[model samples]
Target chain A: MDRNLRAMASAAQERGLALRPHAKTHKCLEIARRQIELGAAGLTVATVSEAEVFADGGFDDLFIAYPIWPSPGRAERLRRLAGQVALRVGIDSVESAEALATAVGPLDVLVEVDSGHHRSGVRPADAAALIEAASKAGHSVRGIFTFPGHSYAPGAPEQAALDEARAMVDAGPHAEVRSGGSTPTARLAGTGPVNEIRPGVYVLNDAQQIELGTCDWADVALTVHATVVSRSGNRAIVDAGSKVLGADRLAWATGFGRLPEFPGARIVAQSEHHATIEFGDEAPPARGDILRVAPNHVCNTVNLADDLIVFSGGEPVDRWRVAARGANT
Target chain B: MDRNLRAMASAAQERGLALRPHAKTHKCLEIARRQIELGAAGLTVATVSEAEVFADGGFDDLFIAYPIWPSPGRAERLRRLAGQVALRVGIDSVESAEALATAVGPLDVLVEVDSGHHRSGVRPADAAALIEAASKAGHSVRGIFTFPGHSYAPGAPEQAALDEARAMVDAGPHAEVRSGGSTPTARLAGTGPVNEIRPGVYVLNDAQQIELGTCDWADVALTVHATVVSRSGNRAIVDAGSKVLGADRLAWATGFGRLPEFPGARIVAQSEHHATIEFGDEAPPARGDILRVAPNHVCNTVNLADDLIVFSGGEPVDRWRVAARGANT
Candidate 1:
């Protein structure tokens, strides 16, 4: 975990980009503190509740990188969060910008420009208008940001980084803090107006990262320690399933998760508490045998766990609470 | 929730089958209490930790329906729980049966037969061998159970129920309390030797249940109240995503989740905190608009939430803690 953190920190520092590691992956106070100690500019969270959790933990600067629509209750929470820390929110629409300003008064905002993920955010041309709208609503438009989530595909990281840079550049003069980059595109984010990168999964690279060629198996720091409960021939059922490893299989994903030790094993079926793994020519695991299973997505997997059992030199070390887990308000 | 509970309770009563609703769905003590009041025989849980949670809540009769391979720590927990409650656990393998008996001492055990799911459980022919092994190890063999998880498909419930009953009947004379049934197959169970139904999701029908023609929209007791965060054309991003609604998309699932208010809309894509919905010929939801979404699978969804906001006639009444939300041991 320290190696991955330092690698990303130095990589960002080398590229002259501010590292605002997304806290949604680890959601651990200790890891966040370590990131800050290693010179992370700030933390990037996904929700108001998450920001509140981190703020309560003494991390001052935080950014909610999603285009959040503040309801009456969330507005009050956002207001309280802004009063405690340097808060930056993502804005992709004029209506939300106006609503947020009205609900919580003027705040630090970033115009979200879509760079081909097409999940959220606005067009590059629409960034200036939304920034103007947010500015008109008495909010300070710090800059623009994009997700580049399309980089999650097998061979799409470099092109996604290019797209992210192009989108930030095309968004015109509002690119002061051109924030972008997920784990896949973070290293390739030096070009164009991009000045900040928020990579969440680099701290705990998972099966997806390894499969995407973004990180190697040695770089993975988090794994679900599962026990083989039942076995028939090469098929074994592990206790850690979607309930622990999470059920976030992408269209291109080979299986629900991957067995790091048994490279030929594939988790073909997963229920809430049982993951049925089809093993290759390797000897099948017997009942009660413990196995380290890598989740497809670290973010979802971490969200499921209450605490991470930190390991050092093949020994159990400490337990880090997933403090902001289930804080998805 | 009351209506759905009453309906399932009465359905089980009519068939002369004990209704042991799986507590893994709600994970709420308040709801579990209500289930007991509605004549549910006992509570069925997925994990030893979950069983312990219910046991701690004062409910005595409990069953861990998975083929659990108890570690030393879990074995101790099981022994403690067995002393506290009328505990019964499932066993599908001779190794696990002997291990469980040796680790926790003689306890009530159920031979798990593979009805049709093929995920866990031994074959019907192998059930007697497991039961004999448990009995020989000085444990009380308490009949058998099967999941019939294949009932989750669109047109497979009836056949799955038949398979469950047939498997139990073929498992020999040890079938005293033949336990089976999921939400889809609960109503269809009654033939052969099946005498108990462990339907988890019947209390809160989700999009999958409705899609499978198992339950109606009115039967859906649980719905995630989310806000529209971003909108572009017909696509609107909601606050609830895979983190809250869960990411269990079966092969035949229509979408990630269903918006009850806008039946035409479909949750096309979901990130950790964002669900992009594509509206079908309906007025696009504006930012900050609250929408109730029924998840693809209620069990996975309930596990993600910290609490369930009880609504009495459209007004928030109480907050029930998800007591065993992450009790996956």
Candidate 2:
């Protein structure tokens, strides 16, 4: 296991907060099993297909943290999942709550609360209405959950977590599992009503984490090992491209991806096969020099690989199959 | 097979042009079989993994049309592919030509001549040098190929095709297969020095094609059938997201994805399970209404799905497994 992940798990344990480590960032059963063994209460999944794979791999307690819509095929799978394990799903509307009642019977669902993501989820004030709807629909509403996605901004996680926790707590008697904290917000998510934290990218921090001053480069356990294929003066091209490190360049992101080993080196452009790098001061790496690239986002990066070769020191110890790698639907 | 695909293939046949369709778009053996039956000359692949999948499925004639850098692993795979089928690879640089000869042995390679994409491939003037390098390395130099990628831009395909044809013809003896056409440029590509045309997206015209005035929405064969999950007054959320339709949204692209069936509806944002939709004078679709979304880029969209539920007029015809769906690296 990566030392950084172990330390993060230790921190969560010390805080008496149950870690429901999100598996979307590293969609490997090995990592999930490790996290569970290290004292994660359950695993957090982004898709029903992911939950299905994890459950098949003996993970009984799982959370499909995303506010997923239940298609007829998907609803059947959810019902199957409910029968197999202690399953918890996310809901944000009365319509969805009604559909869940009709399709999957009585279910334990967390009302998705918006903490500033403005993407999905009901507003903090709207949580009571959803809870009422879930109750009226005869579903077991467990609690409320919100993502501190704005925590990516400077000095936002601590404040966002505080606000998120307050929202969950203020949502009355139904709100119980006050889920909050991303990787960036985990450390700042002080003990409060927040009982569980879903931090996916903490296992393998990215360029965003490094830029946010949340984690050091050494803390990033997983990286795309690429060989230098083109060299031109102080510039060179690495073999890893968008396919290896996903092309998710956020507004605040430094580049397409980051080369943590090579500090200040910028990946200016990415073709399908070549990732052009501009060295700050150090001489360009020779052709065939293996460089470790930390992707801008780990979730999309894991989606790109079929298998992960886990290494302790330089020796390859184990290979983890990305079983849920392409569960897009 | 979709009727539009058959129509497009027939249109090419009428113009006396051979369609060696690019299979990187769908990456399905079933789709390739349909294309071949519809009068396609052979198959074109973007990566070695794609070629391997197609070849293993009894595709005898394969063209790896990308300007691939022959790394040891890729070269070894290519050598195996050469032994299995009638293989023709693409080369843009003299170094790559030399490397291909050493690794893949003597090979029939297409000298990649630049059109307007400016991504991979050598300039037309540089084509002779690359071909000479291949000949010197004791490799069978086939011809030259160019992609009119910039043809996706407004009114560029016609001029781009002319430029590409001139470049190929300028190479003189080295230019045997002056390939110059994408879906957008296929109509402009005439029978001159250009012996073959590689147009992949024409098989499944996308939102990009429709916006580029290359094809009508009705001509688009492949559409992601998504159901509305969440609805507000102004914006609604659908099940199709980046994971399904892909996140390759160009700056000029009108929407994240297009709704061919629901005219004037556009996808504004895409999360993993939610696609935020913004309607333009179009009646808002009710929750559970299956919207047929035409992805902006069909190649990457197909790469996301495990299998394509091929539909012939609202009924499931066949389930085509995307053999090379997640074959990244």
Candidate 3:
């Protein structure tokens, strides 16, 4: 894991925010352990596979922050993990809460409130009804949370945070621990009822972050290493492709990915194993020059690699295994 | 491997077209070995990793169908593999031909001509330039090929194949083996200069094929088995997401994936592991019912799994390891 995690944690402390870094971004045990050592209150996960990884690494506190459906088989796993450490989960609806009531241990449960993203989660007004249902079913309600995913848009973070905080307040005293904000919206949501912040992509900001104006190019901590294989005038081909970087073409994305060093270049197209680049009329990269490509979406990119080559100040340092690279189950 | 692969081969042989099944669709040595036993002429691949898998399994003849740029390291691997088998590769640019000259041994090389896909490959007129470059480098040009990707559109296969055939013929007399056609365009190509066809997805048709009216739902050999985890009056949650089926959203796709058994239900939203579904007043499925989901794209869905469960008449017959599940390199 990157040793600079301590520095990031200290930065979070200065900002007066409790860091519960989302483990779904890296999914490495070493990184999770270090995050805990750096004073992270707990770990946030998107899936059970990620929770399993952190739990096996001996980390205690875990919060799966999705409106997850607790299946019997998976609920058994969660119960086992709950016995080992402090465990919390999220629910968005009365139906999910009712189903989870039978499966989950008497653990801290948060209602996923839809602040802005219009994705999973209930409206703030619906939180009380769901929480009441959970309480009636003998399940403990801990707090309410929302992910301002729409805050990722340029200049939308502040207003999105305000809207989220206001919505959480509208839930009144029932919504005590109002958890809101992602990395992009963290600064805007701090020092409010949304006391806790979960920022997964902050550790390794990506092309999307750059586009969102949340981070500088220098702060990006991860990149896909590719070798130039073919050069045709302004066009060239690199070894990394959709399988490596993922063919996720976001509507406003500048390119498939960005060459961190060669900021002038953009990935024009990608096949499964080869990425095509249009580098204008400049001299194409030599056939063996290894290029560092920063993917547009870091979460999916990390899932593609079996291991990550950790670096500091442009020098290769250590190799961290992506333990749960494709743990879909 | 799929036990019914032999039956699939029999169906193909009845059509008078030899099957050189693309291993890219399902990168498994066990599957490749079975295909060979069932009378597959050779193997087709999109990556060198796939080719290595088949070659290691002792399948001799292999064709890498992508217009890949062979790096020195990859070229060395190709040369080594070439020494062990009859290897043919696709090239679209003069630079790729030069790199191949330096790396590849005496092997058959095909020039990929752009019929209409507009992805990779050169224009029909540019094929001569690439062919001349390859010939000058002592690499014998085998033929010209096109993908006719435009065939995915409704009623466009026949016309796209006609254009593709014209492009191949326009590539001069050196282009002997005019290869074209996928499963959708196989019959529409009309078998002119196209001596061979590579249709890997025919064995397991997907939503894309079904939407294009290429195959019936019964022909789909693969389906994602997901379990319901939560249910309301009409809404339900399942334990499958983008990590399982992939987040490939085609414009013509019918939702993220199709539930063949529960045709009324649709995957409304997906997180990493949780798939939120809206039943909309329909009696919700019981929490344990296994929903068979037909993915929009079978090629990517197979890449996501660690093992493929082969079923004969609905009983689990065998399990084939996805040997090259994350073989991005």
Candidate 4:
């Protein structure tokens, strides 16, 4: 995990961009502190609850990367969190920006520009309106942030980065800190546009990362240690299931998950407690044999886990509690 | 949740079968106690951790529905759990049965039959072999059990129930307790062969249940209360996303989730903290509007949530902690 953190931090440094690795990927305070120690500018989170955790954990700067619907309770917590850290939140609409600006005191708001993943965020051209509204409503406009989520596909990183650059350039005049991210487009995203990147999955590269060619097998830092309980012909049933590996099936994902050890083997299906694997050329694993499975997505999988058995030098060395695992209000 | 519990219990009583609703759906000790109060025969869990949580919480007569891969840690826990209650576990393969028998000590085991899901379990015709193996391993053979998971899709419940009955009948001679389950096929499942059912989702029907015509809007016991943060013409963004609603998009699911208020509006996509909704009506939700979102899969959604705001008579009467939320090992 430290190797992944250093590699991503170094990559951002080489490209002259500040690394603000998304904390939603790991949700562990120890990992977040390690990332900051390795030169992360600030931590990026998805919720106010996550911000609260990292804030309580003593991390100074935090950014809620999603356009939050600040309720009365959330706004109150946001104000409390902001007082403790250099807190920034994403705002995509004029209504939300104005409401947040009035409900919460003194926040650094970023215009969320939709870089093509139509999931959230405002249009790049229309970001100026939200930015202006937020600025007028007593919030500091911090340029823009765009999530190139479309880069998750097999061969779409370059195009997603181009989209991110275009969106960042469009919001460049509004303010200062232009942020763009997505692990797949993290390297390409620093293309003369964004000053900060918030790629989360790069810290614990998964099967999706391997499939996208973003990381090699050795680059994967997190893996679910599973024991084979049953074997029938070429089929082996492992203890790890969707509850452990997570139920994230990308369009191009080969199976439920990937086995780095046996590349030919596919995690064919998963129950809540059992993952059925179709063994490749290698002989079927004996009962009680442990194997590592790289899940389809790291963030959701981390949320499901209680603590991570940190392995070093091929031995279990340390354990880190997933402190912010359930910090999803 | 009370309504769902009553309706399911009543339905099972009418069929003269015991309703052992799977606790994996809610994973709340409070809810499990309520189910027991409502005359539920027992509780069904998916993992050893869940079993441990419930056993500690004082719920007896527990069944680990999945064919668990009993590792050393899990075996030790299972043995401890069994000593406290009338415990039973599913066994599909001979190897797992023998291992579990030797590892966990004397326990009641059910030969799991593949009804129609094909995800886990031995074939109906071959269930006898597994039953025989468990009996030989000093484990008491407790009939058969089948998960009609295939019933989750539209127009599949009736056939899945038929398969369930056939499988139960095939394993009749080897055991005493015949169990069949699934919310979609619960009523259809008590077709004479099964004496008990384990319909978990029926206690908190989700979008998939609504789509499958297994339940209606009024039957939905749980909902994600989300506030609209942004609006773009007919499109509205809600605060609840995969983090709260869960990322469970079935092949037959029409959207990421369903809005009970506007049935026609589709939850087009979801990120970690934002759900993008494209309204089917002319009137769209404004910022600060809270809407109830019925998740795609209630079990996973429940697993993500920390606590549930139990509403009665359109008022928040109780706040139940999801004590067993992350009890997935």
Candidate 5:
């Protein structure tokens, strides 16, 4: 885990870009502290509740990299959180900017642009207009940011990095801190207009990262330990299922998850407490044999567990609490 | 919620079937007590930790309706729990039966037969052999059970019910208490060898149950409250995503979930904290507008939240803790 964190910090340092590792993946205070110690500028979170959790842990600098449309209740909470920490939020629409400004007064904001992911954020060409509107609403418009989510697909990281760089460069001259990059596109984010990169899953790579060629098998730091409960022919049913591994199967995912011990095995189906794995050519493990299974998405898996059992040198070390496990508000 | 619980209890009573409501859905002590008050025979849980949670709540009669393969740690816990409650566990193989019997003394065990769901359980023809092996291992045999999970598909309830009945009958004359039925197949279970039914999602109907024609819209009791954060053209992004409303999307599910307010809208994409809904013909909700969304799977959604806000006559009445939210040992 330390190796993965140090590698990303060194890569960001070499490119003269600020490393603000997204804390949503690990959600552990110890890992976040390690990232900061390795020269991270701040921590990136997905929700206000997550930012508050880190703030409570004595982290002063935090950024919510999400276009938050605060209701009255959330606005009050955000105002309280901003008072405790150096808070920065993302904004993509003028209506949200106005509502935020009216509710929480002046705050640091960044314009989010769509760099081909198309989930959230405005078009790249309209970033300047939103930035101007946000500034007029009594908020500090620092710069622009975009997430290269399209890099998740096979052989798409290079183009996604280029698209992220192009979108930030086109967001006009007022943009000083252009933030972008996911795990797949972090190192590929060239030395251009982008000055900060926020990568969440680099700290603990999962099956998706291994399949995408973003990380090797040795780089993975987390895995679910499951025991084979029942078996028929080549199929082994594990006790760990969607409740532990999570049920976020991307369209391009090979299976629900991957068994690092048996590369030929695929998790064919999963119920609440049972995962049926089909061992194609490998010998199936006997009943009561425990195996390590890597989840397809580490962020969702971490959110499901109350505490993670830390391992070092093939031995149990300690337990780390998922401080922000269900901070979804 | 009371009405839905009562209706299922009444249906099971009229059919002369014992309604052991699966507590994996609600996971709340209050609801489980209510089910017992409404004449439920006992509670069914999916994991050992879940059974431990309910047992700690003073519920003595409990059934772990899963093929549990206990490791040494879990076996020790199960032994302690068995001493406290009238516990009945599901066993599908002679290996698990022998191991369980050796680890945790002689206990009441039920043979699990595959009705149609091939995830776990043995074939009906082989059920007698396993039952004999379990009895030889010094455990008391308590008939058989099968989960009609295949009834989740559209227009599959009738066939799945028949399959369940047939499989239970084929388990031989040693089977006295034949347990079967899911939410979709509960009512369709005819008078046959099956004498008990377990339906979890009937307490809180979800989008899947509504689309499967098993329940009406008014039967749904749980819905996620989210605020519209961003909008563009026909798409509106909400704050509640997979983190709040779990990411369990069945193959036949129409979308991630459904919006009762806007019947024409569909949740197209979801990240950790953002759900992108596409409003087809209905006008998109403005930013900061709160909308209620019904999850595709209520059991998974209930597992995600720490507590649920209860309502009575459209007014917030109380808050109920999800006592077994992460009881996935």
Candidate 6:
């Protein structure tokens, strides 16, 4: 984890870009503090509750990087969080920008420009109205931000990053504090006018990263320690599944997860409590054998774990609580 | 929820089978207590921590339904829990059966038989060997249990139930307390030799259930209250995604989730924090509109939340903590 954090931090630093690592991945205060100590400029979050957790944990700079709807309950929390942190929030529409302006007090806002994911964010051509609305509502507009979420595809990282840059170019004057970066496309961030990069999964490269060729096997820093509970022919059942590993397998991915020890094996399927791994004709791991399995997506996987059993040199170390777990409002 | 509980409870009662609802669905103490009050024999859990949670919540009878690995840490916890509750664990192989017998104190165990899901559990023909191993290790073999997981398909419920029964029959004389049931196949559960049913998702039917014709729109008891955060053309973004709604779209299931408020809409894509619902160029819901979304899988969805906002008569009624939210070992 430290190696991953240092590598990403140095890469962003060399590119002269601000490194605001997304805290939504680990959600651990110790890891967040370590990231900051290793030169992360700030922490990026996805919800007001996550911001509040970091603020309560003594983090002063926090950004909620989602096109958040400022509901009454969330508005009150955002209002309180703005009083404690150097807060930044994102919005993709005029109405939502106005709602957030009325909810959170004196915060910097980023117009969400769509780069290709098509899940949220405004089209580059539609960023003006929301930027104007956020500015008129007594909030400071800090330029545009987009998420290159489409980079999760096997060989689409380069194209997705280029798409992000083209989206920014299409939104000409709104490119000052442009921020964009997914773990799969982090290397291509500085190729555009992006001044800030927010990469969450770089702290814990997962199966998706390895499958995307974004990271090698040695780069994966986190894995689920699963125990083999049953064996039938070549199928080995491990006591870890969607509940522990998270269910974010992209359609093109290999399987449910990846086992570093048994690289030839494929986690064919997952129930709530067990992952079915097929080792083909090879002798399956003996029942009661422990294996380290990497989840498809580390962010959601970390959210599922209550705490992480930190390991060093193949030995157990400290434990870090997932403090912001289930802080999704 | 009350109606769902009563309906499923009465269905099992009329079939002369014991109902031990899987708590992995709701993960709420209030719901588990109400199910017990409605005549559920016991509660079924997926992890040792989950069993501990129920036992701590004053529920005496519990079953860990997965082919559990008896690790040192988990064995210690299981030993502690065996002293407090009527515990039953499932095993599918001689190695795991003997390991579990040596780990926990004298307790009943069920040999897991595969019922066409092929994810976990041994073949029904292989159950005798595991049963004998458990019996020789001083553990009581209660019977055989199989999860009819394939019932989640659009019209496969009846066949899954039949397969469950056939698998039990193949297990010969070890079918004393044959157990099986899934949300979609609950109605067809007792058509064969199953004397006990463990249906979890019937407590809150989801999009998979609705798509499978297991339940209708009105039967869905749980829905994510999401706010429309962004709108563009016909696409509306809601503040709920895999982090809240869970990412469990079966190959034959609906998009991501089901929105009853707009029958024509389908959630096309999901980011970590937003679900993009396309409303067919109908200008979408205005920003800040709250809508209830029935997730593709309710069990994993409930595991993602810290607490549930209960509703009755279209108003907020109570709040319940998801007691076993992250009890994944």
TM-score for each of the candidates: 0.99, 0.92, 0.90, 0.96, 0.99, 0.97
Instruction: Compose the digit string of candidate 3's lDDT tens values, residues A1-329.
Output: 25346655876688777888888888887787778878999999877777887788787888988766676678888788778878888887776777776777566788888787766677777778888887887677888888877776677878887887877776534555677768787666656567778888887878888888887787787888887765666877787876778656555777888887878888887766777778876887876578888888787788877888877666887888988777655
Q: What is the DockQ of each candidate?
A: 0.87, 0.34, 0.37, 0.60, 0.86, 0.76
**Candidates ranked, most accurate by TM-score first:** 5, 1, 6, 4, 2, 3
For candidate 4, write residues B1-329 as lDDT tens digits: 67788888888999899899899989898889989999999999988889888998999899998778788788899888888999999888888888887888868888888877776788888987777778888998877888888787789989988878887887664357889888888888654798899988888888999999988999988889888877777898888877778778878899989989899999887877788899976678788999999988888888887888888899899888888887887
Ten contiguous residues minimizing lDDT sum, candidate 6 chain A:
A168-177
- Residue B305 of model 3 has an lDDT of 78
- Strongest candidate by DockQ: 1
Measured on C-alpha atoms, candidate 4 has an lDDT of 0.85
Ranked candidates (lDDT, high to low)? 5, 1, 6, 4, 2, 3
Off by over 4 Å in 3: A1-8, A172-176, A228-234, A262-265, A280-290, B1-15, B172-176, B227-237, B262-270, B274-290
Q: What is the lDDT of residue A103 in candidate 5?
A: 93
lDDT of 5 at A133: 94
- Chain B TM, per prediction: 0.98, 0.94, 0.91, 0.97, 0.98, 0.97
Off by over 4 Å in 5: none
DockQ of 3: 0.37
Residue clash pairs of candidate 6: none
lDDT of 2 by residue, A35-154 (tens): 988899999988889999999989999998877678889999999999999999998888889988998888999988877766678888788988889999988888888887877766
For residue B283, model 2's alpha carbon misses the true position, in angstroms, by 6.4
Candidate 2 stretches greater than 4 Å from native: A152-159, A172-174, A227-242, A268-291, B1-4, B7-16, B172-174, B280-283
Interface RMSD of 2: 2.7
lDDT tens digits, residue span B79-126, model 6: 998899998998887777767777765678988888899877888877
Of 1 and 2, the candidate ahead on TM-score is 1
Docking outcome class, model 5? high
Best-to-worst order by DockQ is: 1, 5, 6, 4, 3, 2
Give DockQ: model 6. Answer: 0.76
* RMSD each, Å: 1.1, 2.7, 3.1, 1.8, 1.0, 1.7
iRMSD values, candidates in order:
0.9, 2.7, 3.2, 1.9, 0.8, 1.2
